[model samples]
Target: MNEADALDLVQFAIWTVLIASGPAVVVAMVVGVGIALVQALTQVQEITLTFVPKIVAILLTVALSGPFVGSQISSFTTVIFQRVQDGF
Candidate 1:
């Protein structure tokens, strides 16, 4: 592949990775922030309080987004394979 083509592939791969992970990470971050706010307001500064909710939110996000994530990865893989087959 030419340098430009290689760069485009790399950029596409990076974007795909970000897109795949964005939902779960964003959910976890929002949950964490909400939990922190609650703790601040209620004075319930328990460590597990923060960790548990974030973990649960992340897990739920992963579960909910599982199909989307799988499809995105599969599509990226297929594109990669097709490019290879095209002698890229």
Candidate 2:
């Protein structure tokens, strides 16, 4: 309803997004680094080597973390809806 309220909502939205994305991001980073190390050691330098494993790992992470991410988003939505209901 006001700047502070708007800012609060925005901040909360960002945090929710970060929380939801945390696992996937972490998995991707780890997978990417591992792949990079392997490529460095083996000197394969294949584009697919860099991308494929990272993609697969990220997909698997998302699949495994689906429920946790869903609940975080759902909770954020609930809070937003409640604010709307309260005419904020």
* Candidate whose TM-score is highest: 2
Lowest summed-lDDT stretch of 10 residues in model 2? Answer: 45-54
lDDT of each: 0.91, 0.94
Global lDDT of model 1: 0.91
Which residue pairs come into collision in candidate 1? Answer: none
TM-score, per-candidate, Cα-based: 0.94, 0.96
9-84: candidate 1 lDDT, tens digit per residue = 8998998999999998899889988988998999998999988888888889899999999999999899889999
Candidate 2: C-alpha RMSD after superposition: 0.7
- Model 2 Cα lDDT, one tens digit per residue, 1-88: 9999999999999999999999999999999899889889988989988888889999999999999999999999999999999999
Candidate 1 positional error at 83, Å: 1.1
Runs of candidate 2 exceeding 4 Å displacement: none
